[model samples]
Target: MKTAALSVSSEECFQPGLIPRSPRLLETLLANLDGMVYRCRADAQRTMEFVSEGCLPLTGHLPEALLLNQQLSFEQLIHEDDRELVRWHIGECLRQRRRFDVECRIVCADGSVRWVWDRGVAIYNATGEVEAVEGFMQDVTERKEAAQALQEAERRYRSIFENAIEGVFQTTPDGTYIAVNPALARIYGYRSPEDLIVSLRDIRHQLYVESERRSEFMRLMEQHGSVSNFESRVYRRDGDIIWISENARAVHDDAGTLMFYEGTVEAITERKLYEAEIRHQATHDALTGLPNRNMLHDHLQRAIQARQKGSMTVVAFVDLDQFKYINDSLGHQVGDELLKTVAQRLLSCLRDTDMVARQGGDEFVLVLQNQSGEAGIAEVMQRILAAVARPWPVGEREFHITSSIGVSRYPEDGKDVETLLKKADSAMYKAKEQGRNNFQFFAPWMDTQVSNRLDMLISLRRALDQEEFRLFYQPKLSLSNGRIIGAEALIRWQSPEQSMVAPDRFIPFAEEAGLIVPIGEWVLRTACRQNRAWQDAGLLAIPVAVNISPRQMNQSLIDFVANVLRDSGLAASWLELEITENVVMKDAEKTVATLHALKSLGLKISVDDFGTGYSSLSYLRRFPVDALKIDKSFVRDIARDADSAAIVKAVISLAHILNLRVIAEGVEDEQQHDFLRENGCDEVQGYYFGKPMSVEDFTLRLRDEAIRGAAGK
Candidate 1:
């Protein structure tokens, strides 16, 4: 492609001889100049005398059109908006024979405007004749646009910096306040930004409530060159401390020297308080305000880790035995208050390092660290039992509750948290079975007991199939009348190996394995059949009582007893149902309905283990019962313990007032017998009278008693 160029003339001698000789060199030089250079004649309309092809791009007009006057004139090319200004600057410079400089906008042929800086010198003849002018016009559009953009961005940034909710600032390395926004002034309790910069000279001593916080902040910034989410408490202008979170970065000089920090500061006192509340809610029980299970697990884990060398760690499950009675009788609000009091008493039983957690409901778990042996565990357990058994004032009445503790140790009973908890729970059951208000240590033998229970559970099903279970009758003597009145049919297991299994050892197993339903049916049928046999044998007509488990009592026991009596052809008066205090007190309304239904069949309902449960006199009176069997514990200690004697008298008196007969159990001596007789007890049955006997032995005793009565001996 061919290009065009021009040579400078003597008439336009502004830097003459600067033009290149070769057209290509001229073209290259002009294109690289960034603006066009032009020389035109001083005509009525200034005509282009010599033009560089660069003019085509700069003015958006081809050089040929301008040179031949086919395009608009040069003066007319100046934007009309600024033509007078440009012409004035050029005319004035020529009249004074000096250089001219003007900044103006020129309209291109494409109608777009360009900003240009024009600098020119006027040339004249020696005789002072009119001459030509020459200048360089360079584009200044890029610089103009960049300056405008910078201004707009600054405006927006300044608005945000001033109005932001968080504090914004720049601080020097030496802690001097360089600049602060308006929001910072408001946050720091300053009247204005200048007031903060002037008054708060020492950020470490003046701003921070704790001076060490400043040292920490500076140390972090030095190490990382930035600190994000840096939180601290600082004093405002009025000396009130508030929490703040910072996000900051270091701003260095051109040489990368440590300069200053620029950052945003947010007030987080409210959020910090909210987070603390959430943490408290997470760790504390809502009802009792005691430490909850989450905190307990955490404390237990910590205690396990901090266990002393060569010492055992004990984790105890402390459970209130009859708490449900109180909860169901009273209201939940009262229950909550009672639990709180219990938690306080439990906390008093342990050291500060030990934790007592409300493991949900009326159950609590405790962690004991560095115990010497079973002795240490026993001591803590006793303390806990005593503390919980202390009388509590619930509403108007002074209520008392007892706790059962199961202790599991580390390295012996269990090695992990879950195992320890399970063993502790098992031990707790043992404590409850031992009549609550006491503690039991975790033993390797306890594991054997559990394994035996599992083995019994598997064998119980087969035993029912093989008829390995049998019934033994324990006679309940009428102490007032001194005659055979009724008998308790106790279930016993005779293994295929001819081993006699205690009822205590296997009854609980059968109940847990769901085999009691069938075994209890067998006992009922056998007892009824034996009672019919005694009637046929012409012996004294006595009702044979059979114990029904809580599980069995949950079924239609009234209908079952009626069916058994009908099948065996035994009168309803010849069969009686014996139930424990726990079974009756579990669901009082249901128990009352069941008892009434059975009483309608002319069968007697007797509560076993009386004075041993959380039965209220109000609920007891509501039961359709004929007899109350005093718990053996009270009878065992009636001769020695004054409390036992008083309890026995109270129970008998209460039973009589309710129109129920009272019977005493576990009378092992003449002293116990005399005690019961003196207390006005109506019946007594224990080892002192006769131990539980097999069916054949009881039948033989009946025959012997009948012979003696027939002779009136």
Candidate 2:
């Protein structure tokens, strides 16, 4: 067997003893080396021929223990798991005559595990047979542990990116996506993350529904470098629009130069819709679906702002005329339907720029923007009036309703929204006062007039509570015999400060203020109690009639009357209730039902002030009345006015045909008395018989009348 010759320069090929080598230099170099330099035979248990001093620190073994395998073989130091692999690798490298490198674990003398990198070239003889292996072994445990840790951290991050609920994304500053997770793809309605990344090239155009949103996003990013809860509408892959919220930050390098944007996206479409619905409910009326007072105030404020820019706006306050009558008589259900219908009609009459809002109950505020003066406003007002007046069926019958609108123009009718609305409301009351179903523009003088009316309303309510109201009775005489049959009770207010206030002054105000219900109740109870007291005092037993206003008829009048009769201990036959002709015809069906209920209590029902309201013969026939009282207008001029004379004569004939007694009111002179008596009138109540007087005076008059009747008998 022969050995391969070493390839070296002649100057480098010297023996250590001949070259006079420095022992300290060699020892210093070898001690600082990371691993032990070795030469060993290629065997199953590699036989180490020589080893460096670095071996002591690397394997915790002395060089003598490893040399020639006298104490321990180098193969025994290799970890059990890597011994076979090490032998196979070394064998293959020796056969191919090439250098070999491998990583494996080794057990130190202390029984501790350490990872090492071993590199060697095969040493061969002249015949190409393996002789030995020479290599350096270095401890690489720190690098290996660090690399494994980095790999574990990457695995966790990838797992989180894949499984997160919120969409995660990385995009360039120019809105080009670099990476996207599955959640991001799902939010964008795409099949996969790769598909989204490929299809959405320009996020500004392909993702955002509005182009301006991209600009806004850029602006925010430039200003703050980050945005949290930035909400906007965006388009999906399917082109369906949805709302999304993003929390993002501009990713920058060490030099503070923007590299890309990384963010999270959340589908907030459902939340956005819910917020919109909540806003609508807050600003709109529940029943009529019109803008409510809150929204109206906002609109009016805007209108006022426009006025400052030299634009004219009309604030029209509309009130449904006689709505309370319909509400009280028919029911609130019908009233609600009527209000909804009115709202729709008002909307139809206005332009898109105009707004109509419910100010609450039968009252609506209309805003006419950029109006061209009175002419344009008038035209729209007329259309609204006509639309509201058009007959519509409610329940089973057709009903016709009208609106009284009051308008106040901006700059001319005060400056602010509150002032404009106040003026418009004042004008609406003027329209009502002037005979409703019309429109009125605000006038400065209307303020004083409305104030007076308001004062009267306050005073009237006080009078009712203070028991300052008194009932005055006027004797009703039989036209044929000139005998007292009954007395009509009239209300009068004896104010503590004003002395006396006429019924004409406060009654209308009471009706408008909704104070009439309680006042009417007081009048009924007082009148019935007086009548019962007179009969208990052994006076006349003639029935006493109480006038019922139209407002009173809308309430539970039958129940009130029944309660009054029961409380007063007066026979129902001795109490007669007189309702106006117009009241019964307002809601004919409801009135008929009420009249029947009242008549069932054995009370006499009379149609007072008849022939004034245009009552239909068909509905009038259904009324359960015992008497019909001719209105004062007809009786006042019966002797001279041929129209009045004919109406009175025909009324008597009509009453006779219907089996009802006819009574004429306001007969003040001899001629009026003669005409009514000659027309076969059953009873007459007027100044011609006797004027209305106080309770004490009426009691004395009743006593004298009773004595006179007894003398006549």
Candidate 3:
């Protein structure tokens, strides 16, 4: 490593102290040399002639130990495995008369191996036979390790790119595939990455289903420098369409020059199909495969938004008349088939712009858009009436079905979905009232009727909670003795705002609103307790008859009635149930079973409003009843109308023959009373005996009767 004894090539590298000023500079430069400078003989031992001070640190040995093989030859410093390689390389370089450059590992004094770069040229005698060699060697372990690590990283990246599940790609900004991994090729239905890159000369035109899709992707990349979850439809190599989502970023060089777009793609066709199916199931009816109520609302709202000034959006609420009969007689399966058939017919009656949705069983809502006027709507309505009315054959029978349609026009009848549907429903009911197989246009006046009914229903719900309901007792008199036999319980509502809400005004509404059951139970409970109260007051006990609505006549009625009597401490014999004839006749078998069950409890059962319904003589014979109350319609006219008199007389005769008592109601005057008494009616309830009165007034009447009886005795 000593430069002083070497033949100097550079002018500044001279022997130490040869020039007084340059010697110090030369010594300083040699002392700071990065590696060991040495001279060795071209021999098997490679004996070192001179070595620099850096040899101690570079080879873990002093220059004196290595020079002239005083301790160990420089050849021994070479790793055992690299000794032959070093010798052969140096010999070849010398024979070629060139500088030798090689990288070899050397064993250090501490047993640690170090990578070294040995670079030097050989100097020879005047005959050109190599005489000696000079070289510089530096530790290169860090650089070697770094190069090895780079090789491993490249290998791992290639593996991932080849086998990744998601497609990996790099494409030019102008839409040509520059590089693609195996996964990308597979996703695009290509044989290999090379094939994919070669085939997709124009990525946008060949891959994207929409020609403008690539333009949008480029625009997004330019705006944001990245794109995430960019979903689009694209064609595969086989020309089949598939959905794909891409996550990508624009790649750039260090100078911020645009390079290419690199991204990952995920095939999502199956996910897209699954989501679409879920949406379809949500918006469509399972039974009829038509749009359901939710879809109807959505469609109607859209129609309302799209409705223009010169045109109309018509909403038609259609109801199949008496469809329950079909479901009750046949099965739900047949009913479902019929509904589907009706849906098709309804669809056929409208333009393509119109939508028909199943609101529910036997009911459909139609939204017709862009209609010119009532004439067009009317024409469509007529078509629906005829189409739905056509005979539908089920199994062996051909059944005729009809629909009642209610029409509401946008901006005229309503401007919102709820309002439009409600008005349409109101008109539909009006259509049914006018008679089925027809359609009705919604008028402003219809809202009045609908609102009143709705208000009355709302009030009825609060009536029980507010204690606004009262029970009035109308005395039933025995014609033979003219004494109170029993009193019928009637409900009356006293409203602070409307004075009095009559039974006829709210009872029917209460029935439709499912409020009748609770109201009916209250009446029964109150009447039973009142009859027991009269007996406690020392008055004669008589059965207190409370009317039973059809809705109240469920399987639980017997238990409810028994519980009421038990709670009131009233004997079963002291309560009578008066169900309307129509309720009893509606389902004869069920009515018979219920009536007999009540009769078994020792309470009297009677058909109220008799001679008013279609009661088969045979069914009447089996009814478990103690009496029949003649309807007021016949009784009111008995004195003036012969048909009414004959009908009344016939009902009494029939009751007598069946061993049942006959009571006539609405007998207001002498003639009506005379006719009933002469016809052998057992009891009468009318203004003649007494009108329905408050609890206190009725108690007074009962007390007076007891007083009169005592005086007579």
Order of the predicted models by TM-score, top scorer first: 2, 3, 1
Q: What CA RMSD would you report for each candidate?
A: 10.9, 10.1, 9.9
Whole-model lDDT values for every prediction: 0.83, 0.87, 0.88
When summed lDDT is taken over every stretch of 10 residues in candidate 1, the lowest stretch is 1-10
Local accuracy of candidate 3 as per-residue lDDT tens digits, 1-713: 35433324554344476754454565566558877888899998998876777787888887878878888988889999999999999989998999999999999888999999999999888998898898999889999999989998998998898889999999988889888899889989999999998888987889999989889999999999999999999999999999999999999999999999999999999999999989988999988889998998988998889888799999999999878657644545778889989988888877778899999878999999999999989999999999999999976779899889999999899878999999999999899889899999999889887888788888888888898999999999999989888999999998777887789978878867888899988888888988898999888788889999767876499989888889999999999999887778767788789888889889999888887655789999999899999999999998889999999999999999999999999989999998888879999999988999999999999989889888889
lDDT of each residue in 1-713, candidate 1, tens digit only:
22333654443333456653555555677667768777766555767766666677788887776673666788878899899898888888888888889988888888999888889886676888657777788788888778779998999999888889989999998888999998889889999999999999999999988889888888988899889999999999998988999999888889989888999999999999999889989999987788898898787878888888998878899999878667644645677888888889999999877878898888899888888877777777888888888888865678889989998888788777888888988888788879999989777668776676677788888888988887887777766766777777888889875498888887767865778888899989988998899889898788888888767876877788889989999999877788888778777777788888889999888898888766878888888889999999999998889999999999999899999999898889999988788778988888887888998999987887788778886
Q: On residues 260-310, what C-alpha lDDT tens digit does candidate 2 reach at each position?
A: 999999999999999998999999999899999999999989877865365
TM-scores for every predicted model: 0.51, 0.62, 0.60
Off by over 4 Å in 1: 1-57, 62-106, 117-138, 156-167, 182-195, 228-247, 266-289, 292-317, 327-337, 348-351, 367-399, 406-434, 438-713
A best-first ranking of the candidates according to their lDDT comes to 3, 2, 1
Q: Against the hidden true structure, what lDDT does model 1 obtain?
A: 0.83
